[model samples]
Target: MRVLHIITGLKAGGAEQQLRQLLRHLPPEAECDVVTLTSPGLVADGLRADGVRVRHLGMSGNRDLRALPRLVRLIRAGGYDLVHTHLYRACLYGRIAARLAGVRAVVASEHSLNDAEMEGRRRTAGVRALYLLGERLGRVTVAVSPTVAEDLRAWGVPRSRIRVIPVGFDPALFRFDEVRRKTARNFYGLPEDAYVVGGVGRLIPGKRFEVLVRTLPHLPAGARLLLAGDGPEKEALWRTARELGVADRVVMTGERPYVPDPGDDAPGMPDLMSAMDVLAAPSAMETYGMAVVEALAAGLPVLYTAAPAVSDLPADAVPTAWHVPCSAEQYGRELLRLYAAHPGERTVPDVVQRNSIQNIARQTMDLYAAVLSDAPLEVRPR
Candidate 1:
């Protein structure tokens, strides 16, 4: 099969990361290519390094209709048997372009329970009309979690056209590694004895990073904060840290390299995950917390906001790892509790395997094949 994947950009995030993982596992006989509606990102660089063909359409914003023709040309030239897209920009343009190019199979994924990132304050009546138009053009849509599926249905998408498929994390890349733990800590300038409470995502308002910052003063001494990704909120977060008088204790390691999925076949990610004492993702909204699962795979406990999207994680998997009511004080209390318990010392490695990328990819490929088999979806009236 010749598959073409499309997205707004290749920047690091749950959808992009999961798409990259899925591509790495394509069967030997299949060919894969990717198109980014906007300029390619650091993650796309890794994709190109791994021999995947990636094209950047240079979209000048949401209204870049000029890129549509280029996209149409690429699809026609590539002769893709299937076109899979992620996020709103890609879904809107990719589906129409693939259809114009006469590709019979098209699939798109809804990576968030809310569409705020893609549809901002200009979410006027005209925007909704346009969105409904684009959505109606796509053949099938994949939701990363049931919450997302429910939200899509509520937004008028036909239930039959949607499929519930969870995102996958590579188990091998996330396993416990004592040697790597020391190395990663050294690389980050963290003391070997320090308790590291970290998160990996863009420092943005929607992520609720301030909640983590607010929780810092409550943590015991020797506890440090790490935000691995970067974004518009970098300066804001730094200012917040300074205002809170914990700037020196905070480590803002700007965006890092892409960590390939940790399935046995992938390399390096497991070592990186092992370096952390605990992973905290206090996002206000996340379709699927890929990093949370990655932390779980590394045998590290996770602290996250109580969103339905993250509720799928098993109970007793780690100490205070599941979703809880949002409160910086409460989050701090849970973080401290998890730190004291050292849950991984009691949990088995197999607990992480249940949500590995290998299994997720298999399920995704199966869903793709089913959608391609000409079986009509159980569509319902909106």
Candidate 2:
């Protein structure tokens, strides 16, 4: 089974990282390659190191009329059995290109779609029209969470065409270790007893990380807010911390240089998770709460505004995770309350088990087989 994955870029964002991880877990019998429309960066390097062929199409931006034909030619030349598109830009262009290249079995994954916005941009009418148009060109559309699947259905997508496949994490990489925790804390210059509140994922305005920064001054002096990931909002977050007179209490670690490649010396997301006492996701909107899931796998307590990844399950399913409003005062109060309770690493939740990469890869392979043989696309539940 030869497949080609096309994405907007190879930057270290949710969709890009998920694509890399998915490729890693795919069956060896299924060969895969990647195509990035533009700005291939850290994830691109990681994919190449994994021995996957990656091609970059320098077609500029959304209005790049030249990219369509270029992508079409590449699809025709590769003669892939199926083409899977990730992210918004690649979905639109890739679906059209695959059709033009005579490839009928195409699939697209909607990684960052929420009700009001997508990938931090507000969902406009024009965007919806274009998305639907592109969506029709593909045989199936994968939604990372049930919430996103509902969003797609509300937008007029047929229920038969949408698939809910939550993203997965390797439990081995995230299991808690006292020695690793101490080492990671020392690596980040965190004190042995400090109450660390971590915010992971791309530093974007839509993430409401500023809410965490604002909550810092309300917490005890020993409390620290460590934000991982990098983006245009980094400088602004620092300014907010400084303005609140808690600059010393806030640590902004820019983009980690490497991904979660086994045996890599550089500290990855799991190390950052280990260095934290609590994981806080301030975003009110989320397609799937990957950070929350990863923190749970690492056995850290999570305070999140929205995590559709765990929404379908019972509260007992994720006892360590609590829903908190996306406000500085609420977050501050919750953190202080939880701190007084003296929480530690909890067992990995059932949600992680349900979304394991092994199971997801098997389901995906089933989808590919069905699509190839003209079978009805079944919408499997989590």
Candidate 3:
């Protein structure tokens, strides 16, 4: 089957990384191509290296109407069997373009319905109307977590049209390695005996990285904090670290490049997780906690705040993940306990099996087949 994926951009974000991983595990019979509304960033090269054709629309900004017609033309010319869209802007434009191109099958995935937006400025009729319009254009809307699906339903997307498909990761790649852990720590110049607490994601307000920084002062003397990822809030986070008097203990590795080279011996997400003593996810909201899952896969105990993706699982699936309050004090207390009683190897076989990229790709392919065969504009819950 021929499929085309449309995304806002090919940056090194969770959704972008998930897309790349999914494509890598797609069945051999599936021919996939990607089109980014904006310029392709780090993920483009890796996708191309994996033999996936990626195109940039060269959109100047959000107001670029020319991209619509160009996208429609491309879809029509490619004769793709399905159009899969990711992110907000991509969903809005890709669905419309696919319909204009006479494509019968179109699907979109909702990676986040951030709590701040849902309860803040975005809780208005206009946003809901636009979302409903875009959802109506697609055959189905995939929710990365059940929590996101509930939010979509609240925003007027019919429950029947929503499918809960958690994002996947490769366990083999993220699994723990003692050698890589030592090497990553050495490369980062972390002291051998330092107790590292790590967080990974965009340095945004919603992530509440400030809370993690504040927790540093409460931690033991050798406890260090590492935040891997970058965003507009980086400067603010640095300022917070300075004000909290833990600037020296905080390490901000600005957006790590996405290099999927297996044998390259370079530090990646796996190595970074291995270097940490425990992973802390203090985000106010998350549709699916990709980093939490990855940390668990790498054999690190996790202290997270409301990770539906992890919490929704059967308790046995993520035994090492502890749901804690989104407070620096609570997190500090947990860290002390974890430091005292080191969390041993707790590999979640169930989580690894359920969230494998190959499994997710096959499930997604099944959804495509079902959508094509049924050809229902509106579906009823199964």
Candidate 4:
């Protein structure tokens, strides 16, 4: 089986990481290549180094009219038996291009929810029509979680065409390790006696790092905040921390020069999570909470903001986490309360197992086989 995986970009994000998992776990009999609608980044560069055929379409932004012909040409030239797309841009273009190129089958994997598309009749109407076209052209669609599957149904995607495939991470990379924790903390000059609360993300405004910073004052003086990321909002976040009078306790590591390979389950950074007393993910919006799961895998409890997008985590997993109200003051109080409980017993392992990558990959490969079995036989390219 020849499969082409299409994505908007190769940025280091949950969807990109999942795509890496897909490429690594695909059966050897299946030939896999990746196509990016924009310039590939660190993740794409890594994939190519590992011998995956990586193609860039050089499209800019959402309104790239020129991408269609280029996309069609690539799909036709590759003679792919299947085209699998990740995220919206890829899904929109890949399905259309696959059908235009007369590929045997087209499939899309929905990694997270996009609320902006569902906010109104205009976007909703356009999306519904697109999905209808996609449902006919793309033989199957995969939702990363049950909640995501239900969401697609509500948005008018045919229920018959959608299936739930849980996201996964390798357990080996996430095993608890104390020595590594100590090393990471010491290397970064984090106070050993202090309770460390940290978060990881693109440093975007929606992530609510300010909320976490606001929570710092409510906690004990020994508590400190560490943010691992970089974005347009970094300078402003730094300013906020300084204004809060906790600048001394704030450490922004900026973006690491190199992140973990997509195949790696654990982040490349010193397992700082293991050293952390707690992980705070107060994002006002997050679809799947991949970072929350990663922290749980590292045996650190998580605190996420109460949002519908974060509702996918199972109830059992809630015990290991704290969901705070969206308000910064209330969030701060809740975070401090948890910190006071210090090393509270929680089912960190179970939550991690539920989101492990190996199980996710196994289910994905099964979906591939199922989709292929039902797919029409491929015709020779004209």
Best by lDDT: 2
**Could you tell me every candidate's TM-score relative to the true structure?**
0.90, 0.96, 0.93, 0.87
| Candidate 1 segments exceeding 4 Å error | 115-125, 258-272, 307-309, 313-320, 342-351, 377-382
TM-score of candidate 1 against the unseen true structure: 0.90
Inter-residue clash pairs, candidate 3: none
Q: Model 1, 62-153: lDDT tens per residue?
A: 88799999999999999888899888778889888988999868888877546453422344566566667888777778877777787788
In model 4, how large is the Cα lDDT of residue 44?
A: 86
Question: What tens-digit string does per-residue lDDT give for candidate 3 at 1-382?
Answer: 8899999988778899999999988888879999999958768877988889999999888779999999999999999999999988788889999999999699898886766564223556776777789889988998888778888887788888988787987888877788888998888888888999999998878889888898898888899998989888999988988998988988887665445454545577778888898999998778788888888788788999968778877887777889999998999899999989965665655666678887899889888888878754343322
Sort by TM-score, best first.
Answer: 2, 3, 1, 4
lDDT of 1 at 362: 80
Q: Write down the lDDT of every candidate, Cα atoms only.
A: 0.74, 0.86, 0.84, 0.72
Q: Per-residue lDDT for 1-382 in model 2, tens only?
A: 8999999998777778778878889999889999999989889989998999999999697899899999999999998999999989899999999999999999899988887886556799999899999999999999888888888999888898999887865767788877877887887788989999999978887889999999888888999989988898999999998899998988877665335556656577778888889999989888888888888888888999988987767778998889999999998888989899886546787667877777888878988998999898777433
Off by over 4 Å in 3: 118-121, 257-266, 315-317, 375-382
Global local distance difference test of model 4: 0.72
Model 1 / residue 304 / CA error / Å: 1.2
Steric overlap count per candidate:
4, 0, 0, 4
> TM-score of model 4 relative to the true fold?
0.87
Q: List the residue pairs that clash in candidate 4.
A: 168-356, 168-357, 169-356, 169-357
Worst 10 residues of 2 by lDDT: 257-266
